[model samples]
Target chain A: MDEIKEIMLDILEEMTGEPMVKEDLDLNLLEEGLLDSLDYVTLQLEIEDRFGVLLPPSEYTKEELDTPRRIIDVIADKMAV
Target chain B: MSVRFYDGFEFFVLAAILSAPAIWLGVTERRIRGYGIFASIVVILFVLKDSPKSILLLAAYLAYELLLVRLLLYLRSRGKAGKGIGRLVIALALLPLILSKLAEQLNIGGFAILGLSYMTFKSVQVIIEIGDGIISDVDTADYVYFNLFFPTILCGPIDRSRRFSADADSVMPKSEYLQLLGDAMTRFMTGVLYKFVFANLLALAGTDRPYIYGVYMFFDFAGYSLMAIGLGNIWGIKTPDNFNKPWLSVDMRDFWNRWHITLSTWLRDFVFSRLLRSCMRAKLLGGDRVYQACMCLMANMLVMGVWHGLSANYIAYGLYHGVLLALTELYQKKSGFYKRHKNETAYKAVSWFITMNLVMLGFEIFAGHII
Candidate 1:
């Protein structure tokens, strides 16, 4: 779970060009004026590239990207698949 | 005879006529079965009203689509892309575009007259996405509707063929149909206000007034974009917003983001970014953010020139914008001001004013060219 969290944060920062503090990281990234819908797509792509897994583009919705838990959970589920 | 356009009088006349039971009855209800029948008549009407050449044009467009789709299937069925096939696809897609624009400029050949500006970019955008494996499966009807989308044919927001198909194939509810129709009408009325009212008034007032002259462009173009969006809604389709209060922008980047937004996004995705990346790979540019930023602006403006049509004034406009982007980038490097700014809205507003002025001047130059 920590590894998943770390990976998602790294991807977000790279795309957003904004740093995320350890305490500040959460679903707030979506609503807190950091990442946008376009950045979400980039995040999804980056996850697949990094994990060496197939995450079909359609499954990653804007709602899903709003939280850390959901994103990490998705990456874990897809990797297992 | 003096040609009279649909003004207040004509609009009321048109609305009354359109609302008459005889007009849209077949389109709206029990005669909903007449949808395809109505569309066929539309095609036939254009062919007759415009020219016999429209028949050949339609055939040519269809053939081009068939060739593009089948060739992709053949290539993919064989195996994954071998060698530098990406460049090959771009070149192939761009061939007609280059020819079409060059033809328009050189006037050496007959005009394609089939919305080539809109269609060519759309075709190229689709193929690029497909090449990137962003899209894989699409059928013949999707391809046809993307280009032949009627309202956008005459005037365009230059919606891409692939993007249109992707959105169209998605699930749609019957409930969405009524909402979409209502939305279309409301949006269409807003467009009418923009085009016939605000833009018309500004141009009518005279270009000597600097502010009015500047704002006229926003009204004129954003009006057309609204119309395109409205029409797209009617078709249960929608395209990207091509304007975002561009006149209110204060810097070149903001201006680009606001004005002719679809073209700007399209160029950034397909042209500017590609060029900037290539320049980076060639070692012709530095790896740092500032250097990369400069390269991006340069690449962006150069393509911006070509996209507007290969003309001297347009090229100059592109260069002018490139200089603005480069200058702002230099300022950001020196001041680190963009970094410290927490209030993005304030920063954007300041940038907006500056950007809009620059773009308006470009419009002035374009207007001058016509005069």
Candidate 2:
């Protein structure tokens, strides 16, 4: 879970071109304008490359993965399955 | 017989009549449950404006979508939300809109609805989301309201089922409603200035100049989009803005981000992103990101162009933008010079000028004057 969280934050940092902190996890990525629908696809690809688990595409709305926590949850859920 | 602008006396009167009660509800009760009533009224008004015969055809179309959703839900219950089933349901949802466009091309009449294209887009989103298990349950009333959300039905910022559902299910707090009201009025007045004052002036100046026509179109359509967003606010539904300083964009991708934003995002989400994902999964182009992106951008833009119309001109328009966008992606990623100078102010200015003109050319194509 911590590994997934770190990977997610790394992807966010790469996408946003800034170092992300722990507080960023609680912020709504979409609503805060840190990411967009298009970026979400790219983020998924990055996660797949890093973690080797590709969340099913088009199976989830951005809202489902709106926060870093939610993203971690999705990745963990898929990995567990 | 079609009422187009808010500036006209008739439209103003109709808007006043419709908005009065909605506003009252927003101010007093803070819970606007009249979305159904408002949506129904708009559907009726649309039919009346287009053709009374339209009501029957629209009802059939709506019934078809409703039945389609029911079938999709049933399939999910039966654990049949497989890839094939998803494609079939999406195709079924799109059929009426596709047929309508085809009929128009064939010069056949009487098979179209006023907001069929936008309605179909919403329906497909709902079906896809449901199949994904994102939307677990379907409420018939909510579905109706979603499709018929009048402010954006005619031309959309393409609100999503999940986001819109959140708004439709809750009433805003009084403070929030007041803030929304303020934003709504500001947007509405800005739209009037754009559409009525500026765009009309540009139109009267003549469209012989391609660039002039482009500016005219931006104001005209952006004006409508602003009004829709604002009107949506009045109704307590937070409609997304379609335009965002599109002319200031520095590339095709940036232009898309800033212009008719919702439609572009819709194309990205439903068409481009899906194509990209499927290509990645299938290892198409041997996992070459550039080749995959180029293919997806082309397909996405072409579909968007064809969605506007089936004519050769429209197809060309789509291809033109598709090529530009693909090229922009290639340049942004592959060129060392671009990577080095992309952030420099001078380089940025030149890129902005080039992108803005290209977009204007696109608008000219949309205007159907320049082939």
Which has the greatest lDDT? 2
Task: Identify the CAPRI category of the predicted complex in candidate 2.
Answer: acceptable
Q: lDDT of model 2 at residue B26? A: 76
lDDT of 2 by residue, B1-371 (tens): 45543545766666667787777777785566555456556746644665767777776787889998999889899997898998999998998888889999999986678688888888988887777676778887778777777778787878887777678778777788889999999998999889988998998998768888888888998998888889888888898779999878988888888888888878887889888877877878888777788888999999999999899779888999999988987887679999799779999999989888888788778767777
Error of 1 at B158 (Å): 3.5
Worst 10 residues of 2 chain B by lDDT: B1-10
Listed for every candidate in order, the interface RMSD values in angstroms are: 6.9, 3.4
Model 1 segments more than 4 A misplaced: A1-4, A14-49, A52-81, B1-48, B160-163, B166-174, B207-210, B276-284, B341-352, B369-371
> Model 2, which residues run further than 4 Å from truth?
A9-39, A45-81, B1-7, B35-39, B46-50
lDDT of 1: 0.63
What is the C-alpha local distance difference test score of each model? Answer: 0.63, 0.80
Instruction: For residues B58-93, write the lDDT of model 1, one tens digit per residue.
Output: 557657756776676567667766536756866776
